[model samples]
Target: MATDSAAWICAALLAFLPLSTARAAPLAPGQPAPDFALRDQHGQVQRLADQRGHWVVLYFYPKDDTPGCTREACRFRDDLHALLALGAVVLGVSLDDSDSHARFAAKHQLPFPLLADPGGNTARAYASLWSLGPIKFAKRRSFLIDPAGRLARIYRKVAPDRHSQEIIADLRALQQGHAPRP
Candidate 1:
């Protein structure tokens, strides 16, 4: 009976462990961004290699159209022109299907591509995939890839409302040949 009670306590504790703790080590700055080809909201294929010569904002979110995810997408939408002016393109990735991405993009009027990573392959490559039992999702992480295809920065924890502005500031600093803030 004592063994059974101890096992139950261990199981309870394990159940409460955050999924983020299970994620693989994320790619570090200066590492080459892992190349991938995935379908975007419009069913168009987007490849990281094709984005050479441009700054790429590769963000991974947990789900499509959720509260925080929506806020993040809308923030990017609002800042799309500013990002473009700095030679950057934003691409949001999530473990959602194409149809879900389409709706989310249309609803938010996002000009950038929201890549459908249904199988979480791209997220796994970035080490941003989070899973709890049979349920899997992407962590709220962002990677800034330089025009040279190297990772310029990685945001391990993101604040949805402020992330876009933060990226813009970083881009400006990078463009001015100054190192981004730590």
Candidate 2:
């Protein structure tokens, strides 16, 4: 009975720990964003190094067309022009393959590149990969990389419906040489 009671206490303590604590610490502001070369939906390679001198919104999603992922993608799609006007380029990352990304992009008419991270390397580098048993998925997270390739901000818990607008507001503030809102 004592052994069982101890085990239950351990389990309860573990359950209270935030999932983020189980993974690596996310890339914080002022850290250099990790460079990656992954194939986009169009089968062309996209590299982070190539995006230098432009603000890059690197967002990771769990699945290609799931409800939350779809909402996030469509939100980005709806705000593409405004993002572009701010000189920001949005690139989405997922553990799904290129074929899946292509279908998702087409279904939503997404104007941005959805990069495929089949091996989850980029996702892991960004501390956005979630694994359970034999399945792996990318967490819903976003990194704002500035022109110098440094992380401007990191959004660990993203609300899909409002994330695009949030980023846009941040970009506007950042571009005007003001600190972004918390």
Candidate 3:
């Protein structure tokens, strides 16, 4: 009888292994961002080190052409000027292929580049890998990388509607030498 109980407990514990493996923590603020070179929507190569002197907004989404993702891209489109003025460049990252990214960008008229993290290399590097059951893509996350290639802030719980405005505010504050709000 004791052996049966032990076997059941072991089976239960083994069943939960997949769940524990699925959840991953995102990158912490103040850590040096992992550098990567991925192709943009146009197949143009983009590397983190290339934009060393400019602030980089590295945003990773689940897929392209989705409602929330579209809204987030549009918000960034409308706020591009403000962000550029604050000396920041926005780069959207996703697991989508280059063709999908191009179509999404053209459809939405996004002003910034949409990078393709085909193997989710950049996503994993930034700690954005999504592992909930069958979902293998990265979660919708945003990282604010400073000019020196260090993560200044991370927007884990993104508000797709207000994402652009919130990022602009954070950039403005950071540029003015103020700590971003929690």
lDDT at position 164, candidate 2: 95
Candidate 2 residue 138 Cα shift, in angstroms, is 0.2
Among these predictions, the greatest TM-score belongs to 1
What TM-score, over all chains together, does every model reach?
0.89, 0.87, 0.85
Q: Rank all candidate structures by their TM-score, best first, as comma-separated numbers.
A: 1, 2, 3
What lDDT does model 2 reach?
A: 0.91
Q: Which stretches of candidate 1 lie over 4 Å from their true place?
A: 1-26
Model 2 steric clash pairs: none
Positional deviation of residue 78's Cα in model 1 after best superposition, in angstroms: 0.4
For 94-171, candidate 1 gives per-residue lDDT tens digits of 999889999998888988899999888889889888887668898999999999999999998899999999999999
Residues 3-109, model 2: lDDT tens digits: 99999998887676544412655567999999999999999999999999999999999999899999999999999999999889999999999999999999889
